[model samples]
Target chain A: MPQREGSPWRGLNVVFFRELFDHLTSVRMLVLEFLVVLFGAAVVYFAAEQIRNTTAEDPFLFLRLFAPPGQSLLSFVVVISILVPIMSIGLGFDAVNGEYNRRTMSRILSQPIYRDALLFGKFLAGLTTLTICLVTLWLLVIGFGLLRLGIPPGAEEIGRLLIFLLVTIAYAGVWLALSLLLSVVFRSTATAALVALGLWLFLSLLWPALAQMLGGVISPPDIRFAQLGLPTPDTLAWQQGLSRLSPGTLYGEAVVAMLNPDAQSMTTLLAQFQGRIGSPLPLDESIVQAWPQIVSLIAGTILLYVVGYVAFQRQEVRA
Target chain B: MTDNVIEASALTKRYGRATAVDGISFTVGRGEIFGLLGPNGAGKTTTILMMLGLTDVTAGTVRVLGHDPVREPLQVKRVVGYLPDTVGFYDYMTAEDNLRYTAALIGIPLADRDKRITSALERVGLQDVGHKHVGAFSRGMRQRLGLAEILMKDVSVAILDEPTSGLDPHATSELLEMIRSLKRDGVAVLLSSHLLERVQSVCDRVALFHSGRIALLGTVPELAREVLGGGYNVEVEADGEGLALRFSEIGGVKAVDQSGPARYRLLADRDVRPQAAAAVVNAGGALRRLSVEEPSLDAIYNHYFETHGGQNAAA
Candidate 1:
């Protein structure tokens, strides 16, 4: 690499603080934050109410606040998985293109700092905002669980919840990075935002079903499994691998491993046949099971960020 | 250390197959107001961007304050402030807040920022409206705010691109006065604009750009002498017998033409109003109006382009 004259992160703090202030105070962010809080509290409250009556002597009762059984569709994890992308995209879809449209790109770039500081600072700010939101939502769920269940969570439960929170942040980072990449790639804010939302819908809501079909075609079920009306291991593994390509799927699987300690592996059906049901694995084992998913989420975030950084650095500052 | 703060030699910029700025060279001296006069897409803005290191220099080199702009952009940008064609600010931010943000970017100390911002705003006649949001500012006010940004930086060089492009005459004049003051403070000012006449008064020297090249570069009078063949037009309105002949006999008078019944336009090497008036009176003619028209950049540009087959020289 050629040596640059000064630090590439010269004005990083300035850009970061300015962007952070803007994001925290903006009306759009305020609306999104309010929506997430409202939905999160309602889901956690319902989960707590059901848990209070259903499970009397459960060891990981508090972990169910996030991914409560029998209401998987509207649990805290499901709400976060669906809403985090929207929130991240909302904060980032116009991060760079908005500067171009407002005619501020040239003026800002003309400052003493390199373009690296601007792109990096914006990404950091968006991630920081997501962190603040996710952390607040995490605290709210735990507080609701405390108030409704009338018992302090075990240390293991707290550890699992903390891990879940970090995984959620990594999940948020993925969407933020993707939206920032879209912002750099598209010059028009409307187009960037539409494309980001379109991708989010396809990856989050539609990709799993498509992945299953593609997996089945790629690896037809074995004759023995077909006769027994069971999916072959190859077809199931292919489906899981293809679906994990989506950030949302990666986040969902990671959170399941963190929040549901009984989730032994990616092939949960196969793990169930091994005769270890209702016995939660240790926290370390859960982390080991979730390690690949977490790494994939973080890697996806960095990959998107690097792509956006390259595009931003090469872009002309005339606009 | 030299008097020339900005030096670009054989500077060229090419975008793919198209050249935005062909090989052009010029120098801006300390405290001098240098104008880049060109029509749209004539590479004036591109040239400015290259000098500020906002765009890559494709072939040749540019040095601001003796440091190469492309390589030492941070050092160059620290001392050189740029005002883009249409300067923009955060609409939700007050003017003071916007300046503070820029000051932070420049790494100005907290104790000095408020004082510098206030003084800069005062210098630009925008002190009273510092608390107002920039969204409500008029185009001219925005331009002044841009100048205030430069002044706040206390930069040695200022690059303003089309600073007076969209301003009213009054605003334009006020802005030009501010530019002159910037020069008075010993700051080198490099401003680009197509409003030839408006910027002509403030420019110490101008480079006329056409088709990504400097077709003419000098003071207005020097350009007029080079292109229009004469630097002065002495108009004498009088009625007399043999008046045109009498005026032609004066020193430095090249040609004489009777434009109206009592008016004669005399092309001269210098201001010959007094001599022309003497000739008309000595010839027993009543001199109605004797006026001299100085060389104008507008006329020189028109003449140069007209003779050079206009401004259409390939993309």
Candidate 2:
């Protein structure tokens, strides 16, 4: 669709292309890109190794790379969940504050473009750059699988692979929006960057533990059920549900569901599936199951981005 | 189009308990050079920000290009070019790249942007250094680049906030000359500066700001007359007291005092030169020197500031 003339979108293309150029050439993104591919490839190697050790007839060998391994090495999902935030935060922590530091904010805002175009253009540019990075990483792992494990992914696995990439992009959007918001709130670029990384650590690593503790405190295991030798399934369910509030958990659930067709739910449920057949759900069913997680990731992105937008619009351009 | 490119009436801005600009009103006409001359914190910057709609007005109305900047900022900004005090540019970018980014932001079409940028650089005398990174630029050079940005926009009104705040005498004069050229191009200029002499020299008229109020406003000579009230300071030096006595006999001399040996300080209601000089030479005294000192912007500014109970802000 054509954008209306003199609309706020008039400058979006100009801003987006310029920011994209900077993001592509900047050393900060380059270093983060190297770390992600390096760490990501290492996990892919271990997964390929695990698959090779297993039966040659294993149909889901390529998909196992995205799941947690039986061994102690970090899985592809965990590595992606950790790395996406760092990459995203690096891209956006300096987005607004760096403009202020460089003294470009006043000059740019004085132009004919509306504030809407400037902020929206920045976000879209960051998301596009992230998409490019993730696509390349996904291709690298799949290529490795093809060359080392000597297995090509089937159509169902390919569908799951596509969904995983989308989920990863959405997760990156959430962190990118957060970093942009921090950039607008804090004056110093370094301060914003530090706060964003600290928040990431709290969310990914610390929140799960805190949520588990808080959930247990909030809903202590029923003593009668414990005395009957039955697990306090409700308390555990609530704790896991609270843990799922984290983007890391959402991403973990999403990628695991996409990468493993045999896996039905994110939680363990051997007791509930005792009489079930060995047949796995189709790719569509898995995606339908992951719809809530996908929506949450996107919703989180929108919520953060809206806040950043309003703050940026109200900010005084003077140094 | 109205003669006033920028019009503000009862413009007010307050920050909680403190009023930054209080009931200020001014108009900037096309092809006119109007100056907001004031010392620091006299509400000049705040007024400029409110005019540009960078800050909201607490009360009252302001229009740039007949559009309320707060309601139609893009429309106002399109025709208005602002060079803020000590404006910064992208340090990593070359001068051309910095301009290119501005062109993109201003929505200058690609086909004509290069030509406009080239001319702007040429006009600002930064053509030779267009490819050098702005980080390496001297402060004066960066200021000229700021002018180039203003030129590239082809804006109708150029608002410059303290454009020569930190420039050397050489750079300051050069920038003033370039600003005069902006007038020749029929662009309205609203420049704020604390330098009364520079403002008086360049501006067609000026408003003297004192403690959030316009203490005086008019052409330089008019303001001088307003504050000095038709009185001119005169000095006459001769070898004899005859010159002092003859100077006192002049028609317009209001008062005479023998301030030094054979030197008479006289206050006159009119140009005392022809009458005082004639009197001195005709008196058979050696008229060593005679000077009729017109009131300067400095004295006028000081008079207004003093009357308004502000600290003595000498130019």
Candidate 3:
């Protein structure tokens, strides 16, 4: 690398604050916030109602608000996994290209700052916005749980919930980075948005099924496991591994581990039945179990951001 | 340290196979208004970008205030202000807010920001509309706002690309006057434009760009002399006995032609208006009109291109 002259972060705070203000006041953000809060409240309310009737003496009742046992299709966690990507994409799909369309890129770049400051500031601003939104939603869900269940969460439950919130932000970071990368790659805002939404749809809705099919082809089930009508361990591992490539899959698995402490590894459900039927695992153990997924979410975010930064640096500032 | 604020030597930019700026060289001194005159795609904007360190230089070196733009971009940018061809601001942002954002980026202290922004806006005659959203601003207003940004930065050099391109004639003259004021403030200005007549009035020196090369470089009169073969054309309209003969006998009058019944076009090495008027009145003739046509940039440009067989001379 050629030795650069000044600090790469010279004007970072300026760009960050300006972009944060824009995101906070934008009508698009208000609409997305309304939708997420509406869906989140409804899902958590239904989950809390169901938990109140079904589980009378469960130790982790507050956790059930996020991943209610009966509703596998639309739990609070599931709603978040699906909508967070959309919200992130909304914040980021036009981040860089909007400047180009407005003809402000050259003027801004001519300031005494590097391109690093601009891209980093935009990413930080988007992530901060996502954090604020998710934290608000988390608190709302907890408050609703307290009203409906009449039980304050244990310190451990709150800890796990906090971890879950961080994991959710990391997941949001993944999609935000991907959309920002698309913005840098495409000059037109419409094209960048379309491609980002298309990618979100593919990863969230179609990639899980595609991964299973591809895994079965790659690692065929053993004859002995097939004769006993049991899924082959190697084949199951391959499918899980392939599916984890999608940020949605990683987020879902991490939330499962965080919210439902009774849940163990994907291939070790028998271990759960052995001696831990009535007891939940400790928060640390749950985190250890979900460590790889958390890392993957965070790594995917950094990888995407690095790619966008490189593309932005190479781009011409003419227009 | 030096009087020159911008200096580029053998500056070149090549996009893959074709050269955009082909080994061009120039220098802009303090308080000087330099014009980069060219047609579209003549590489004027590209050259400006190279100088601001907004684009990479394929070959050659550019220094702004004795700092290399490519290697020391921030140092150069700190002292240089650039107004792009189509300058833009956030449409939803009020003019004051937009200036505030730029002020933060330029690292102006908070204590000084409002005062500087107000004064800069006042300088551009935009103080009254500072609270209005920029989306409602006219093209002339936006161009003025761009200049206000340069003024707020208090930069040593201001590089403007087509500052008055889309403005009406009234706005164009207003912008040109502001450019002249920038010169008066000891700020070097490098402005690029395809309009010759408007730019010629304000530019102290100009480099005519053609196909990525400086086809002509000098003051307007110097260019006119090199290309037009003569300095001044004195038109005298008088009626008397042998009036044309009397005017032709004046010193420095090269040739005289009877253009009309009472008009005589005198080709002169210098302005001969006083002598011609004196001769007409001295000979007891009624001098209808006596005017000197200083060599116009349009004529020099057209004549040079016509003689040189330049096919791309659209401007």
Candidate 4:
């Protein structure tokens, strides 16, 4: 770096640290983290209490805290599915346009750093912040589970939980990259945030409604079966396939199968194999089951991030 | 072995169908204050952006510190620091914090960072207020803070885009003085200002930009002589009733006009201070003041635009 003869990432460290400090101290990030952590911990607490009172034998009891343990009070997975997108968007929706609006874009570009370093650093910094936030909440849940259940998680349980933590981070990264892409595409931070939040609403609330309609067209369960209140297997498969397209659903599927080893399969086909397996599967076996869902989540995150990076690097700084 | 800090040849920049800068060429040498004199939208800022490699050159090439900005932008940026026309910083951070972040961006090592930041603040006269938030700083102070950033980078050249813009007369003068000091420190300074009178006092050489092309390039004196067709406008003052009539008869006097009791304006093709003095003495009147001046830059700019048929007036 002293001679400026290396890759463009030579200035990446400086950009990363500066952005990390900025995100850590910003009022927006602090407020979002507060809401997410408080709500996340509350859900895990209720779920942990519900699992403690279960009469049936559950081998992977600690993992059951993430999936629904009892009543419909919203499991930890459901809370995160609803909240992580908001938190990640809050962290990144102002990444590029905010700098341009403040007249700081030219000044930063004037430094020895290339556009690659700046955009990459910003995305990594935001992702790292998300990772730290998610890990802390995961630890809090484990701690609360230990206190309530009086049973420590075995090594296999810890390994599965660690993978779950990584999957959640990858899931948050997708929203963060999508938000960063919006920030680069829009010139105003308000517009970027609005569009990102609009997309979030579309995925979380409206998409499900639309999916129900599209599911009917893709696999009509036959109007005659509707009178018997029994849908065909085509409708069930299409509905599951449609929901799998959402990152939230991808994350939920991956985590539930990997975390709860007692889950034999992720589809209605589970009824065929339920009586065959009487015990929980090992951590590696469960990961093998969830590998496709995990790969899709990671690939989706990388694709979104690369799109943002390329768009930002191609952007011109007029000043 | 080259003396130039920046050399741009056949530089052109276009946005869509509109060309912002067209086939311009210039060189900024060490310790020289080169000014880009033009009106708003004259492509001065675009040229600077091209030099900094912040924008792609639509055509042509530019070499900064002997490295092509397009291909070796990091090396070029390492040696050249740009202070934008209207600079901004992280308003929530203190001045020191802002400078610290910039130092990191430039790859300044941690061991030398504190000392360098302090000296840079002291150099820009911001040391006393380094702890203050930038949001509360006035426009002029922020401008100086921008300078501090360049100084901290310790670059060989400073490309400032309208550095004196939006400042009061006093602040403008102080900034000019600061730029002068930078030149004394062996730093090549290239600044753009739309006002000729302001840059005339600081620039050693200037390029007059009209419609994205250099209409004229030379020292201030050369431009004055070439554009106004050659001469000195000499004003002579005496306290007699007939001195104006007598002073008009001096040698090499092209035209003469009388203003008051004894004041006469003589447009002389050569230096006529001595001949005019002799005539004023011979008029048997008291001599008070004598002034000689060349044609102003404003006149040269107007003549240039008119001669070019006003093909591309910057509106």
Candidate 5:
């Protein structure tokens, strides 16, 4: 490409193209992409088949039992939650430190490109790869949804899915930034990888359980608190409020509210949504209801990413 | 020299309590092969790194091509090519691929890259080995490949650290020849090497680095003149005793030594050869042998250690 004069980011295009070409041509990403798609398709096909065999009388209801009514979007969201973090950590974690170890950082830093270009190039590359993977997963899910339901999703469903994708991108951005930050913070690839993996595991899997344990320790179920306890009506509300502090649970709750707009009552939010289109509820109605949790997820993702970017910018590239 | 290619003024680098490079100042003139001669840990690598902007300078300024390296690093780095002492390449790539990668990374034009790559490899005498995997190449070949990579930049200055460190005599000769060729092309080279003889032969000037400062800096001939004055010896079969009497009478003759029957070595300040030869002829003696001795780089190095002491010899 052509270099832009008087621009510090002139060589940013070079870093971008280099990373994009390497990732696209790499055997590991190609193999993982293929395996993840194939596995996801197989699982969706088998689940659709099983739903057809048992719940043929009322497919929508059966779908509601497993997912929300008229939408098997839960499968896609769950798959994304699991795979996005993996893609994030896999692509990053070595972006900076690996260059230092390979002695290529000297060559790269010696170029006209600033360090900002290098960091931004890596961040964008990882985000772009994860987005492509998520889009592929979306197409497959919608294709299967059409085949099984014999109906294309309407404007409302598509809009919700789009929102879901944006939120998912934000979520992936958090981890991408974290991985890049860790890559610079550590001198070795293995150490950075371990730190990234550990963070992913804590946020995705263990964070919710740890929140519950904290809740129990702070407000034990057996103890009779005057306001909020097991026997008291406020106990459930207390537990729900405590659980929202976990990032995983907060993101899951936001996805549920976005997917099931009619599930207004807290009890039915978990039971499953049953609603039709054309008598569309105001977007704010659902947003206001889930505003606390969704805002938390968005804010958390942005906050984490900013911290990572700042740390990365301050890191010394010398090994 | 009116054109100074590289200049460092009191450049210092300290890693916590340890001072890696300590207030070393030197200037390299355009098209000159300037050698930074020092032992290991004499801050040669650190000095090179600081000049290249790879490490932070704790104290003073470094100017390359009239740009402060720390502030206007990209400007200086763009026009300067550096080869670290232990050059490491992306092992999975072939020689051509590696060079092409470097060419692209440095923003070499796509249209001219192939020609540049071919010419650079050919210059390093690696034209036949261009297709081989760099990982499989011998250390000498790697060194040549590293040189080729820098040569593609066609930079105004080249900083090389121990370019012939692990090479055999033949390989070292090839590398020295390559460096000398760069000088012919008007590329100013600042290299640190332990090969004193090669430095003495190829470099027009040198700086003997000790404890992060230049102990001596000048042309080899200029240094030889300072460290070693004029000296000569004439061995005669006959009339040598009378010749000594005549030469001692001459103001130019300083001292005389006799080792054998027809062998005598003399020390003097100026050319007394015509007078001494005439004195021998007049005294009826045949001048069998005549020679003059000059100090070698080895002796200068030994003198450096002797005067500077062993503690700072390898500084």
Candidate 6:
């Protein structure tokens, strides 16, 4: 066999190009981004226009409501929060399974490249495309906000917006890792996509509410007889802890903290639980405060990716 | 295993409870066009997959180019280019794009990729259609493209699972020529096919896969010997059965049978055409005509299946 010496990064570079070219030209990828853009444009245009036309005092109510004459970290996170997971799922749900279905898995596995190259290459390519799309969306949103409001973001606001971008990407990475696991587990691309969407829906919409109800049912705390029954402390704590386990909740809370540190009143609970809580920090500070959540998001993503790697390595692509 | 570039030892691959490839053993030597001949669902694809490390071996060891396919897959894969039974290409891309993609995935350097792609396309006689979308290509063209993808890597071994399966006669001939070309390049090729003619045309050596085992393994002539009981059959047109019997009693004749009213078949271990002819003529039988027929490979292949009914034959 002909052997050539090269750096390990060279391998990754090859994989990255292959995947990126595929993603760039793939019909499905085009369909997905087109739909996202169409829907996003509609949502932003109609909502902002309606609000601007109705609230005559501030034509750029959406921008001012989220951030006062600055880059609204809240607005960016909200838009990305809606867009990130969708893009991640769209990019990743079929990454491995599609290869398996196309019967290319064997041909690819028969190559000299490592499985890591395939999986990591796909993620990096998707991340690159996603970053480009998100940044463009940010510029557009900020440009429109500037045109309407005629002010740039302050230093503190920009810092918050940067943190929001970081956390949002971290959140999106978690989903990307998740979809990879599903792709490895399910041989059919459609089935993997369905399973990923199901997981996304369950975590984002259904699981938190279910956890709250479950905590209430499992251990109903004593309530004062004077007022109607309300959520008790132990119930609240159980709910909070249980919700933390849901990746969706962790991602959402992190984004909210990064965008708007005072979005929720966590101080009273911290004071009650830890007994020596300090004043609330700024939005950026809150992202630092929620380092464990960020770590958990990343750790969860990596852990799933590792599991997927092992599963794929064990798979018999001959089928 | 000593001379064989790939040695599969009692390979067995089971999916849940369904056995895909039963315990099978075989060896492929250098520069040999080894044909794994079998019908569909006969475990030929599974066997090739195991050899290429595409499937887990339930119970066996597969060594490709002196490395375990399962454990040291990258090493084996580096030296082997596999064309799956049904070659699926990225439909949206051009043939050139697909080649580039495969080359990259196989770790070919960017500078080398262009040269490899060009040469590979040319090798498959697909140079002009390089820029055409694969979705528009016919099944035969796709098969050739698949072959080009593997050839581009410049690997020492090519494992083709049913290489000429869906090709027309012309395409089949072209594909076979390509396979023959591999031998000239000193690349060992392992191809599986049910088309006897295809195999007969290109394969230097062949193995008849029956129930996941190599029932008959040898060159076409060797297999013909084992299957049809190697020898020449002498047919003599005689005047009478008595004279034919006398001819059969000749020292060199193994057996004799009356195939027709005037025709007698003499089975001999060697060429005894002259002896049989003389005996027939001296025995007072008019020898109208004499002809010799060599046993065919197809007959040998049929006898292999006939003798070995299933995997139970070994027991």
TM-score of chain A of each: 0.96, 0.92, 0.96, 0.89, 0.78, 0.81
C-alpha DockQ of every model: 0.75, 0.49, 0.80, 0.57, 0.31, 0.45
Clashing pairs in 1: none
Error of 6 at A215 (Å): 1.3
> For candidate 2, lDDT tens digit of each residue in B23-121?
888888889999999889999988888877677778999999898887777888899998988889878789999999989888788999989999999
Ranking by lDDT: 3, 1, 2, 4, 6, 5
Q: Name the top TM-score candidate.
A: 1
TM-score between model 2 and native: 0.93
Segments of candidate 4 deviating more than 4 angstroms: A1-5, A70-73, A218-239, A270-281, B230-232, B240-254, B268-275, B292-294, B307-315
lDDT of 1 by residue, A261-319 (tens): 77565656656886677678889978888899999999999999999999988888888
Summarize candidate 5's per-residue lDDT along B1-315 as a digit string, tens digits.
Answer: 348989898989887898767888889989988999987777888888778766677998888988776676678778888876667777777899888777876789999999999999999999998988888988888888888988998998988888888888898889889999998889999998876766667777888877677777887656654554433333333444566677677665667776667666666655566777777887778876666554467677776567667666444
Ten-residue stretch with the least lDDT total in model 5 chain A: A59-68
Best by DockQ: 3
Q: What is the TM-score of each candidate against the true structure?
A: 0.96, 0.93, 0.96, 0.92, 0.80, 0.84
lDDT scores of the candidates, listed in order? 0.91, 0.85, 0.91, 0.85, 0.72, 0.75
Summing lDDT over every window of 10 consecutive residues in candidate 5 chain B, give the lowest-scoring window: B229-238
Candidate 2's C-alpha runs over 4 A off are A1-6, A228-233, A265-279, B230-242, B245-257, B264-294, B310-315
TM-score of chain A of 2: 0.92
Candidate 3 vs candidate 5: the DockQ winner is: 3
Please tell me which model should have the higher TM-score, number 2 or number 6.
2
- Which residue pairs in candidate 4 collide? none
Can you write out model 1's per-residue Cα lDDT over B129-226, one digit (the tens) per residue? 99999999988999999999999999999999999988999999999999999999999999999999999989999999998999999988889888
Instruction: Indicate the docking level reached by candidate 2.
Output: acceptable
Give per-model CA RMSD.
1.9, 3.5, 2.3, 3.2, 5.7, 5.0
lDDT of 5 by residue, A102-219 (tens): 7667666665566767878777877888788777777777777777866556665676677766667777776777788888888899999998888778866777776666666665
Candidate 4: how large is its RMSD? Answer: 3.2
